[model samples]
Target: MFVLTMYVMLLTLDDYKPTYQDRLATPGMMIRPKGNALEISYNSEDTESWDLYVQALDNFLAPYNESQQIMNNKDCTPNTYFIQEDAGEIRNNPKRSCQFNRTVLGNCSGINDRYYGYPDGQPCVLIKLNRVIGMLPGKDDQSPYVTCGAKVNYSQPLVAVKFLNVTYNADINVECKINSLAIANPTSDRDKFAGRVSFKLRINKN
Candidate 1:
């Protein structure tokens, strides 16, 4: 069985108090540049790690945008915001984390989660952010700190996953593993099973 793990770092920024012309400079950019951007990095050892990470990130961010809308009490519907995913693999186990850094336009807060699939067609894993590792920023902090983790029986294979946002950046690294049970009896006519996949996600401000 193949074991996959991933790490991601995210950057959070707030206080986009830019002037009208400054905002006009980039009319359509989703994240306005107003405050310092938080920098987050994720690391993983398994191949296909980045794919899972991106999937979770997409899932997490979609709701985050909505939460922001509710907080602002604006007439806007919570919609998916576009993001760029740039990731790479590290041969050395010591350097197996994905890095996310950006300057956000407004005040936002949230947490991130990691998800992945297991061998033997088991359910997907859902890693929730624990208080120790998944704490968000308080109402009066510089920026919120995101947390991440996994749940064993809450993962599934990537057949046709739906993401709320359009991915502007993405990177994938994958490694395949043979199913020992399937290999043991070639003539058994059992379906071949894929290895496993893992992911990371960040929460949006509330």
Candidate 2:
């Protein structure tokens, strides 16, 4: 009887499928800048580990032409803006918890990129900024808190290594795990949901 019972239980287990609960951050969720960096961590008493993804659309372009050329000796104002329109906002609120299994990270789509297979990619976190912040490069001898080059249309999203951090699980999927992401500044008009970002890892010698 014991042997027969064990076999039946095994069959039941094989038919089981995992049920995941997705989460979203509430509006007005605070995301403040810290010195040269801004970051967030994942915490849930019950939720298990999950994956993170970003996909800067194949056609993401900065809304403005503010980025100017760097003169040989003089300093030029950064074309990038620290705050973005489509992006959420920036406020100094106590750190909040992350939503679980939620694919959409930001308030709008332009910047809330989930993921899609692409050969060329960069490491980034799919997140929603309360406000779309511009790349306010570091001035003087200070290394740019966050820096990016000329805006390239339909190009991979940029990463500001000195500016963002994800500290829940140290081991992250670069395709999903990253130390930086390029958040472009808009000098013009934009749609409601328009930006996206994605990251990729070199698997083989392809």
Candidate 3:
């Protein structure tokens, strides 16, 4: 009688970074207060209704806080993607991620006012791009920036309301597009949010 034995082996990187990515969809923009539906509705007079929105922004920004960033990440040159050729590891570390200081957000950072403008009916909506490994955004000297405008009038709309009037409720349709030469803007309805995002903002006093 003859017997045969076979051994199988799977190879992976030492740093655990994916050797190959099979993602079909491109990186897209995302907004807070996420749900099955993409709509932001809040009562201006009710603090309870908008406090959660402020909490969401605070939770989202916790990692980007100044103290947290000082420990783990290092600053890189602005307006340019930092390319490190060393797969060889740095100071016994496999990789070092760039730090995005929360202070860069300025007034929206939730540093000075913890309300994040939500209580005043001037909520700060946080929009961010999904990260893709080994992806280079923009081309030449042109950098990628997110441009948002009102969908109805096709112009920038005022996002703040000093006080809510019972007779007038602010309702605005907004669309944000990521502008970059390296990105593809899909025209099909199926791929509507490919390089852009759209949502409605409704602030009511009642």
Q: Work out the TM-score per prediction.
A: 0.18, 0.19, 0.76
In terms of lDDT, model 1 sits at 0.24
User: If the candidates were sorted by their TM-score against the true structure, best first, what order would they fall in?
Assistant: 3, 2, 1
Please state the error at residue 127 of candidate 1 in Å.
25
Question: By TM-score, how accurate is candidate 3?
Answer: 0.76
* Candidate 2 local lDDT, 1-206, one digit each (tens): 99999898776662223233222111111111111122222222222211222222322212211231111112323343233133255433332222122122132223343322111122232223232222323334332121122111211122222113323335333211212223232211232222322222221111
Q: Top model by TM-score, which number?
A: 3
For TM-score, candidate 1 versus 3, the one ahead is 3
Ranked by lDDT from best down, the candidates are 3, 2, 1
lDDT of 1 at 101: 20
Per-model lDDT: 0.24, 0.25, 0.61
Lowest summed lDDT window (length 10), candidate 2? 26-35
lDDT (10s digit) by residue, model 3, range 127-185:
66666677677678765666675211111111221222322376677677767766665
